[model samples]
Target: MQIITASQALMPEGWQSDVEIRIAADGRIAEVGPMTTRAAHHLDMLLPAPLNLHSHAFQRAIAGLTEARGPDPADTFWTWRQQMYRFLDRLDADQVEAITAMVFMEMLEAGYGAVAEFHYLHHAAQGQPHDDPAEMSARIIAAAQIAGIGLTLLPVLYQWGGCDRRVLAGGQRRFGTDPDSFARLHAGATRHLRDHGHADDRLGVAPHSLRAVDAEGLDAALALCPESPVHMHLAEQVAEVEEVMAHHGARPVTWLLDTHDVDARWCLIHCTQMTPQETARLAATGAVAGLCPITESNLGDGIFDGVRYLGANGRAGIGSDSNVHIALFDELRTLEYSQRLRDRSRAALATPTAPTGRRLFEMALAGGAQAGGRDAGRIEAGAWADLLGIATDNAWLCDRHGDAALDTAIFGGHGQACISDVWSAGRHVVQEGRHIHRDAIRARFRAAMTALEATV
Candidate 1:
């Protein structure tokens, strides 16, 4: 068991002072009460660490490599995707594990205690399955174990290149799998996790997108994991929406809601292209809108309609999609700023009871837990001990208390520096603003990048 005492802590009931928390051997919070004089790890301010609802861990390796403009007049997500595919063709399982470890460590340092990896890269370089069909997924699981980050492994079903059911070519070949093959792969991954993963690890299924999976394929994927979390990329780009419309005769979200039972267990990634009616309809379905603000902006994808969506009590969480930048506070700030920029207003997501920063933080906590299907997002007994320690003495947080501290940490643009410690499921993996295994992880990632650079 581990014990921690915080001068201030955010509990589900609200902020508490002089709180002491005990983490059981099983990684759940054992107890919470007023602090005693017993020896315990001390924290200046403690907050619940949220799960990153969506991520493609390998994409972290191609972060800055796609910034250059192609021959097209306007660089868009499609152009960036081509570069990403070219990069992944050179990646092997060892390189993928190293890159994923680095990304998971960075996420820990950035205050994300867990992640839902939207994994789709399944086959070998030449579109052939490895002897172990779940080889790539096992690499991801190994990386997560090394980093001590709670993982929600989402094995994606990518059956087609587009809505027209074209064959996957080039880098897309690595992600191709029919429903029958995907079922075996999913079972293998589940067995891998059961044999090797930590207690907090989970298995989920993702239907890559409407363009990649047809009605029958989606149904098969859904049947594979009926009660687990179901995630899908929905209406991320205008081109994608148009393609779905042309093929399905309705917009992506509209058609999805009409066809399936999308409820609280569903997490739809990037509703950036939704109409007001679609937004309201999706919100009413109790599905989480997984927003990746930094990646959305970097790809030239339009801003999500946060004001209208949240006003309808929609659930939302943030993710470092492309991982071009992996800062939790920056993701939240970018989300709120995007809404303000779109409407020419201030504190666009603030409410009557909570301020902007507090409101965003709370909503992210709830939505992230719900989307990842993890029993975390609160500093309460029986919850996973996913917590962040912030230093009140830092320049960005000095002399701040209550919601003001969160506001300054987020809006002051130096929030990452204030993170002094992080615990994911009672594993203290990050300390003093750095991941505990930073040096080793960095060295491995550097070697992988050096080898990848020669080929790409």
Candidate 2:
């Protein structure tokens, strides 16, 4: 058992001060109160570490490489994807393990206690199935294990390139699958996880998106993992929304909500192009709207109506998709800034005297855990013992206390502050601002990237 005290912490309503949290060996919170008499581990800025609700782990390495536009002046997500295809061809199982470990390390340091990896790169470059169908998925799982981050391994079912069963293009080959192949691969990946996944690590299903998967395939994947967390890329781009409306006679989320019983079990990533009616209907579904504000901005994707959606009481969380940026503060800050820009208002995420940081943290934490199928995202008894520490000793945070500290961290601060310690499932993965496996993981990552540079 361990009890750590905080000068400030994020509780249900706002930042509470002089709080103590007790963690049991089984990774559950033993107790949380104003004070604790228990003897054990201690931390400084203890708060609920937010879950990274969506990621493609391998994209971390190639993040900066896609900045240059092609011959066309207006390159977009479709254009950037060509670079990604070439990047993945350089990765085998061993290389994937190296890359994934580094990615998860960055995530852990970025205050993500857990990740819901939307893994799709499975087959070889030519689209041929690997000897082990889940070879790539296992590599990602291994990376999570190495990093000691909670894992929700979502094996994506990408059945088609379009509405028709069209053969995937050169770059998409690695992510292709028929429904039956996908089902088999998903099962193998699940079984592999049962053997090697980290404790508290779990499995889930991703239908890639409506475009990458057909109706029947999506239905089957959902049925296959009825109880597991279901994630899908929704309306991120206007182009995608147009395509969905063209094919399905409705927007993606609109069609899905009307067709399927989308409850709390689902997480719809990106839902950027919702109509007023669709937004209202979606808010009633109780599903998490997984938003990647920074990534959305980078991809030239439009913003989701955060004000309208939250006003409707919709659950939402953030992710570091594309791995272009991996800072938790950046994601949260960008989210609020986007909303402010859209609404043309100041202090968009803030209330009269309430802390915007606390509210955003609470919403993201709650929604992220719900999306990842975890009994966490809170500093309460029965919640998992996941906490992140910030360095109050820093000059920028001087004289700040309680909610103001969080306000500084999330809104005022721009880059990584001294994250002195990070505890996942009551175990310390980072101490003194460094990950336990940072050195080793980084070595492997260096070697992997060197090899990748040779090919890509």
Candidate 3:
């Protein structure tokens, strides 16, 4: 049993002072209240931890390496993708585990209690299925298991390389799968995570993107995971929107809403380039829009019209899509900054009643839980006890209170002060702002990168 006392903490509806929180043996939140009662153990500040709604763990290594322009005339998402493909030339199971472990460990330290890895790198180096089809995915799951972070293992299904259903390009081959092969891979990943995700862990599915999946392929993959959260890349780029319009009659988001029976179970990653009509329609579906601000900014994907979307009461959450920098603060900061730049206005993340910082944090928490298919994201009984603690004594946060603390964090505070401690499903994965597995995971990562360099 564990008990934590916080000078101030965000409970379900609002912030409470001198709060007492209790955790039972099973990792579910046992109780939450004033610090009148005591337990076997107690600690300081606490808040529900943030969930990372999207990630491609292995892509963490390729972050800075892909910034250079390729031989292409115009460098864009496509050009950068080529660099990414070239980088993936020699990632076997061991390398995948090492990189993913380090990535998850970093996320834990950064106040993200859980991660929904939109993982699709499934095949071997030559685009062929390994003796075990889900060999790579199993490695990803293993990394999360060893790192002790809450995971929503989303095994992605990729059938085609582009809108034309062309054969997968060299790097694309690593993520391709037919329906039967995908079913086997999906099953294997689920089995790998079944026991691991009871009170603390989770699992889900991602159909890489509309461009990478055909109608038949999408249907089959969704059928296999009837109840798990299903995510997909909807409209991240202008070229992708154009491709979807050219191939399907309408835009990608419009087509998905019109064609399928999508609801809260779905998360549409990036709806960056949605039309006005497409935006309202998606809001009506009750699906969460999975946004990745830092990665989108890095890739120059156009900013999402968050102000319009929020006005429609559409749900949305932020993710570290490319794992470029795995801080929950960066995702929130970039999301707001992108909106501010797009509209040239201040407090764009604000709702009508609440302050901007509180609103953005609450939405990401709520929507991320939906995206991850978990019962979490707030300080409440019965919800998974995933919490993050921000320092009250930080230079930027000093003399601040409530929403001001969060606002200062986005617009003033450094990343380190904002991330003090993190808890995942009632377990303290990060203590006093450090991930317990950091050093060991990072050592393995360095060794793996060295090995890959030799292979290259």
The best candidate by TM-score is 1
Ranking by lDDT: 1, 2, 3
Local accuracy of candidate 1 as per-residue lDDT tens digits, 352-403: 9999999999988999999999999999999999999999886678858889
lDDT of 3 by residue, 1-456 (tens): 777777778777787777888877777788888888654334334567778899999999886887776777788988888778987878888998999999999888887888898898888787877888777777887898777778888888888878899998889889888888888988887777774443466677788888999999899988988888999998999999889899998789888888899999999998899988888888888999999999998898888888888889899998998898887877888898888887899988786778887888888889999899888898877788788877777666784666777677766747556577777887777877788777888899999999887876
> Looking at candidate 3, what is the lDDT of residue 388?
83
The positional error of residue 450 in candidate 3, measured at the CA in angstroms, is 1.7
Candidate 1 segments exceeding 4 Å error: none
Error of 2 at 257 (Å): 1.3
lDDT of 2 by residue, 239-260 (tens): 8888888888988878999899
Q: How many backbone clashes does candidate 3 have?
A: 4
Residue 327's lDDT in candidate 2: 90
**TM match of model 1 to true structure:** 0.99
